[model samples]
Target: MSFTEPMGRQRADDYRSAMVSSDPLMDVAAGLDAEVAQYFLVSARCGCFMQAARSLNVRPTQLRKHLALLEEQLQRTLFRFQGSALTLSRDGQLFHAQLIAMAHERKLPVIEQPLIRLAVAQSILHDILGRDLVALLRRNASVRLEIISLDSDLSLQAVSADVVVWLASTESPLPGPSFAVSEPERLAPLEYLPHIAKRYSRVTARPVSLDDLADFLLVQWQHERPVESFRPWHDIVDQRLAGVVQLHSYELMLEMIRCSACIGLLPGYMGRFDRGLIALPGLFDQSMQRQVWMAVKRESAGCEQTRMIVDLIRNTFHERREWFDT
Candidate 1:
């Protein structure tokens, strides 16, 4: 393909002028093969003909022939061999710089957006992080963020995510260096409080005490796999209570509490988002609180995008600390 085909005639003339007059070899800029120039650029960037060939989806021999044609056209040696390593020659470096500048001037695609994958606990994602993540996407177009809702018992090491947000009890906190995770940051405390829908409260007498919950249907969120350290409703309600319903999804549990005459435990912060939910008074205590931790994989901790996301989450939690307070 000819690089000038998509560019306006004046822009193509400007591109040629930018490359010409600077170097004797660039004098032939008017006759440069765009495809051959691209092949040379990729080969220079990869520093290996085979790697560049794979990136361009072309055979190694074909990539070599294309670069050879570019060198013949420009009358300059574009690459040199040092031991087993392939490197751009002095002439090649100059051409590479000019090509980069031309691509920028023409507004051509040069780099791919960095992708950062975030794995979050189901409840935290729905109740808190989802909005912040959406705002981040709108604010930054250079980065690609993937939000994965974790609904099962998958460990941090098992999931292929750059960042992880999960609920951790005091007894079984986030794993250490062995899990290939950086030092975890405690984002916020989740104070679980009993809540009943406003409509449900009007239909039935508000629970005055924890024991009063036994009279109403209880909707509880149960993990797909048993987590011994996390028991949100440990002594608050009996699982053997007659009308108790267990569910694996936090969303379903919230919906059940809102639509039926069922009472369930939710984080204190949830009351701010769902005004329809009324927290039962005098039922919450310090024992019901759990910690929310955020950590990045050790390998991804240095990424700027990952750090940016970490800061956004940290700031959101800090700003909403009051909502999580009992």
Candidate 2:
């Protein structure tokens, strides 16, 4: 359960010898056990036994024992521990690479598709990435995607998601050293414009001032309101709006606005999809803008599947630059 000392020169020699044994029978017969290989791979990716245990749904002591047994069988120290922190040794990295290759080779000939986990805000998923993801799946039947709608308090590290797309303001802080994160790719800020269904616009007189919003029902997206930065408008209209209906899903909010006599704020890009919606004039304030960003886990950054998803996301924002513009 304890690994206080670092791998020394003698241990390094033993690792190299085990990796390239002179006996061909020893090499072939002593290939890594499947279950133990899984333990080491997960531990290396997680950077610590505790986290690896949590990920594998096993006790830390059990995981440590399995790793220790694997090291004994190979005559190599695969991991080093300083205090409570665990890291893979250089030999471990080489072995890990070999294991990954073996895994990929085993999945050949249409057995299992590559799975990429994407964690994103509900609004973004509903309004933007949903359609794009559908298109991606249709084009590439070999790719499988697991889309997780980010909760207010969800941690990307906890979910083991490969990529994350979220509003910058609501992003979770970077995880600890045990988890590796790639540099974030910042996207253009999205502009939210007030939109009313044509049916609602027909019955109400459209005024040219901010005060006009006070007369209509304000349908607010749960995450975007109360537009606190735009105090002039927030104070005069949003806070004093006669009726407010808060919704969690953008799709539902759009339907509610389209069918009822209410005003809703939606991303400008959405206007292209719903022709029945009309933008309310004189309410496009700068405070309605929100920045968005995407990040990938370092472990998954080099994966081709992950790269494809990242490219798709970046392209989605790029193609809609005009919709996000202020």
Which candidate should be chosen as best, given lDDT against the real structure?
A: 1
Clashes of 1: 0
* Model 1 per-residue lDDT tens digits across residues 1-326: 12223556675565566566666655554346677767877788778787777666577899898788778877888789888888766567657657777677777765675799888888888888889887766544446778888765555446778888887665455542235777777887776677888987774689886667778898777762344433546544455547888887788899999998788877777779899998875764445666788888889998987899899888888878888765
Which residue pairs collide in model 2, if any? none
As for candidate 1, its clashing pairs are none
Backbone N/Cα/C clashes per model: 0, 0
Full-model lDDT for every candidate: 0.73, 0.68
Q: What does candidate 2's lDDT look like per residue over 91-163, in tens digits?
A: 6655664566567767623345568888886777877788998877655544678999863333443566888
Over 4 Å off, model 1: 1-109, 155-157, 175-178, 224-241, 284-286
TM-score of each: 0.63, 0.57
Q: What C-alpha lDDT does candidate 1 achieve relative to the native structure?
A: 0.73
